[model samples]
Target: MARRILQASFVRRAALSAGWLAGLHTLAGCAPTLPVVVAPINCPVSAEQLARRCQAPQAIANGATYGEVLQLHQLDRKALRDCAAHDRLLAEMIVQCQRTILDYNDRLVEINRRIADKP
Candidate 1:
């Protein structure tokens, strides 16, 4: 009788967990989806704006922002050798362009706050 009771309790707990997992999946499925689109173009400097406009093709030329780049600063020796053969300036420009975007966003937020305070 004791063994029977233990088995019943285990089955009940397992069923509860299964039901909870199903509910989580249903909730996740209800989330709104984002569209896959090209990145925005709004650089403060026209040179940087042109660079932003040309980023995709430049990235392809540099071949530096691939799956391997996600490994952080630890690049494979062979890959680094290959990248050195390509246009290093392209990668540098991309990094600078991204930094400019972050700075621009910060300045815009500050300017909007000042404008809002007037009225």
Candidate 2:
């Protein structure tokens, strides 16, 4: 009777250990994912986009009366101001992009210099 009980207990422990090992083996498949590669940023402002964004408003007709012409001049001045503001913004954006490119180039040059100097 004692020998039979011992045999049964050994069988039960062995079965549990096998099941645990099998579960761990299946779980190992979840690791080791592939790395993702990213493309470089190429955000150039297109000519078509510039043409569409900063277009001038329709031309105003010449006024008949002196007061009317003065009011028209005011309107024309405001339109010019708006156009100038848009142009300044575009210029600033171009300068900023140039600065960014130059900054990155400098960094890359430094990195290359350091790598070349390494033993």
Instruction: Using TM-score, give the best candidate's number.
Output: 2
Q: Model 1 reaches what TM-score against the true structure? A: 0.32
- Candidate 1 off by > 4 Å: 34-119
Give the TM-scores of the predictions, in the order they appear.
Answer: 0.32, 0.50
Per-residue lDDT tens digits for candidate 1, residues 14-86, read 9999999999999998765433433555533345434432212112235666664655334444456555644
> Model 2 scores what on Cα lDDT?
0.72
CA RMSD, predictions in order: 20.4, 9.7
- Identify the candidate with maximal lDDT: 2
**What is the Å distance of residue 18 in model 1 from its true position?**
0.5
